[model samples]
Target: MKSKKILVWFRNDLRLHDNEMLVEAIAKSDDILPVYIFDPRNFQLTPQYTYRSGVIRAKFLLDSIADLRKSFQRLGGNLLVLTGYPEEILPVLVERYDIAEVYHHREVAHEETKVSADVEDCLWKLRINLRHFIGHTLYNKEDLPFPIKDIPDGFAQFKKKTERDAIVKACFLTPEVIAFVAIEEWGDLPAVEEIVSAEAMIGEVHQELIGGEEEGLKHLNALLEEGSTIYQKSTVKGATGKSGFSSRLSAWLALGCLSPRMVYWLVKDAEETFGTNPHFSQILLGLLWRDYFRFMFKKHGQHFFNDYAMKPERLFSEDREKLLFEEWKNGTTGNEYVDNYMAELNTSGFIPHAARLLLSTYLIYVLKIDWIKGAAYFEEKSIDYAPANNWCNWAIVAGGGKNTGTIKSAFDLDKQFKLLNLVVYKQ
Candidate 1:
């Protein structure tokens, strides 16, 4: 019998450890082709800025793909890099190769969901079976107590239900690496300039962080030992607060270099070792918040894309919307504190979580612009950006995305200034 061939589609789940799809594929097949399609649409989607991706994020993605190639080679497999719509390219691969099935981690957001659907449709037309596994979060989607449609509206409720009544499952072990041809032969990784034009990155900084599974695991281990304990102190202490511990894992998790389930288990282990400490508990709270956003997104679905994920009917003025978006993106709307944080993110593909919430509320509620625009802007620039947390959190502060029907006035920057012990700003 001929060796069965399968294609492992790479997306957010970029690592080999505890990867359900890869394990299943290896169990079922003798040969596997690891494929990563840099869908042009991802870079083409224009968010609040004229360019869809900032240089920092773009550069980071380039580095990440490079890293994946190295890891795949170590594991005895190869990564195929292609630039185009997956729907269009997947079929071509199916015809050219003896593809028995297509395996990948499931995607849930509006855009990714649509892309997966498109890929499924095209593959079905070609008579290729597509297999999707759940591995991103600690809780598997099918195992959730409620269906995606019946998920609750608030994070507190979602967290309570999951915490009290449910469990965060264990991770699956990685499959043995299947040795194959080198990825460079499939297609060379694109240069930063090749992915987007120089004009697209005019004001955007070009410093992207390194990306890959090894880097992701290294980051995860670092957070457990040093990050959780000093999180509050570092953030509160300013410069020292930037402890590489803020788990800088967001970008990796977003890209699938790390799995949320693995993150949860690591945090739990850290707590077992040092949960009694106040600093460690504080760090655990942040991890819980990350899970909270994931739960909220599962419940809300694409409703997250609207101005107010919950209050789609409520509308903002056009002029206010345009001006606010410009100010937030440029980091120069005369609000020095807000500008400071925005400038940090614009220059470095990073911003602390506290700053993220503060600046988002400022842009949406205080500026009275459409929160969707702010979400879009962050999506473009943030290395760790996820649609659910980014968009739903925006709605929460903007006084939307809730079942409570309360649209509180946007956050008061003056109050935030006082809380941060910075010189207070007046209205």
Candidate 2:
């Protein structure tokens, strides 16, 4: 019997604990190589003139991988960092290292699908077993009530369907510990300048946002000890009590440093021990919404990024709105609520969900800007920015061209002022 050499390629799933792909690989192989590629293609803009990822996220992503490398080394495994396409680099690795199998989390978005296909083609040439695991979402797609083609058109319908019936009983898989393979020493992580050209976008935004299993577990324990019980009340308070109840687990979830299942189980445990709290229920609602959006992307394909809705309506028009978008992006929109939200997005690369909704509505309804522009800006800034949510929400707000009821009613600035207790800025 030959000893198996399996390569567990880390993409967004950066952590070790409760990682299904890592667990599967370790069960079959003694010589396991953990690899994370800094795909230059991911950091570059397409010829279509849209950035694949924004500068803040680019920096954060590199930081996450760098952080993961350090942790992997401590655990006796080395993270192999390579530059260029995975198809180009991975096949070379298989030849040099005698890799017998490749394992990674399954991703169903447009770009990832292409990358997956390319990797499959390359691996087929090498005759290695290519394995992909469902490691990202709150619920497994396979366990859903319907096929991706049959997913509900509206989020409300989808959420209800899954919560009521299709929900899978959650399970957490533990990774088997494998002895580290000696790989060559890699240099320091790439700087913002090396990956991107934006000066306003360069900074270590992730120093506080640590990566890896140990750091993730520490943060989870800290939140739980501080009472993960209070998340709902905190989330409603927006920026202030956000940490108290909201879990702030997004960055970790985005990087795959922590599994959504773990978060779900812990909250369930808290509810069992401390009893039902409205706050906890609200937090769970948010998680369910996140899962709903993921399932949405799987069903809709790249239509998720376009301005049309699931009902085949054109929701936003580029020509109908032009100058309004300039003001919105520049934070000179004159609408205080919208500008404030933009400021938060520019500064921290984050916005509370309510803020995002209000501001996006202001763009499409009040100011009449192309929703695609707003979505593009979000793609460039948000660390947690998932395309499905960003584009779908924007389309819904912009009224799907024929102006469906799904579009939120255009907000009255005066009413908003009263709700937010915002002082009127007389322009």
Candidate 3:
């Protein structure tokens, strides 16, 4: 009998629990090689000249990778951490390890999908299959009521149909033990400075939220035990500038340190234990929104990053536009609420969802700057930035995407501020 060797490529899905790719690889292979590649391209400047990922986000990612490696170690396996392009690096690994196949989670955004395609192409030359698993969303795409092409353009329709028809799948059991191929060097985790620019490193690190599956799971458990009153009040205060008290699970979810299904089931258990909570529903709705954005990206491709609905023209010159953008980015736009929110984002690499809405509204409708630029800045700054959610939400706010109907006049500044119990800012 011949032994099977498989390579498990770790992308955003970085955890041991609820990882279909890891479980599948363990089930099928005699020895598995788990690897994570820190692609330099991800750290390069965006087209809008912002860091593709700022220093704090880069640090959080590194922390997650380190934590994941520790998890594999505890399971009697090792994770190979390398810094290079996956497309170029994976084939060599496949050949060296005598891997019969590679398994990875599929990504939806254009850049991520392109990287997957490139890796697949390279692996094809080696005649080794690269199997893709869908494990990111709370609801699997196959379970959806509608096909990708026919998915509702508006969230309301999508939410209504999917909630009624679809079901959240149970999480994959965490592997207790694993066999890893022999390697002299698993590679050292790089420091945050090595992965980002000095300029990006200027801001305060969001040290309160440490990265890794252990921390993520702990946070989830703690949140559930805290109950609805604390959760609701914290959320309200976060919006009203009292304290940053939202779930803050996004940092973990964005990195795949926390599984959405795991979140759903755990929240369900909490509901069963403590009775129904509206705040719990809000958390689930957030997961649904996350799924919606990813599916929308799959459906629309690069169009999510474009001005799909053709936004009204702005009269400002390029120089004037740059000035306005700088003010907004620096939290000096003279609008007290917007400035405070921007300051929080710039300093901590995070802000509450309400802050995000108000800030987006200010940028798109009030200042009349290009929403793409704002999205680009977020791509650079946000520690929890998921490509689909970030870009698609910006498009929705700009009134230039399939979601326009779902959130009619979503960027109406006065209405948004009032909803948050915030005083409308005067220009």
Name the best candidate (by TM-score).
3
The better candidate by TM-score, 1 or 2, is 1
Q: Candidate 3 lDDT (Cα, whole model)?
A: 0.84
Q: Root-mean-square deviation of each candidate, in angstroms? A: 4.1, 5.0, 2.7
- Model 2 agreement with the true structure over 316-424: per-residue lDDT tens digits: 4755345556667667777666676676666666666666666765655455455666777777777666656566566656555223433433223344335444443
By TM-score rank, best first, the candidates go: 3, 1, 2
Candidate 3 or 1, higher TM-score = 3
Clashes of 3: 0
All candidates: TM-score = 0.86, 0.83, 0.93
Which residue pairs collide in model 2, if any? 76-180, 231-245, 314-400, 314-401, 315-400, 315-401
- After TM-score superposition, the amount by which residue 306's alpha carbon in candidate 1 deviates from its true location, in angstroms, is 7.3
In candidate 3, stretches whose alpha carbon ends up further than 4 angstroms from where it belongs are: 232-245, 304-312, 409-413, 417-427
TM-score of 2: 0.83
Better of 1 and 2 by lDDT: 1
Estimate every model's Cα lDDT from 0 to 1: 0.70, 0.67, 0.84
Model 1 stretches with alpha carbons more than 4 Å out: 45-49, 179-184, 204-208, 227-245, 282-288, 304-324, 404-427
Best by lDDT: 3
Better of 1 and 3 by lDDT: 3
**Residue 100 alpha-carbon offset, candidate 2, angstroms:** 0.9
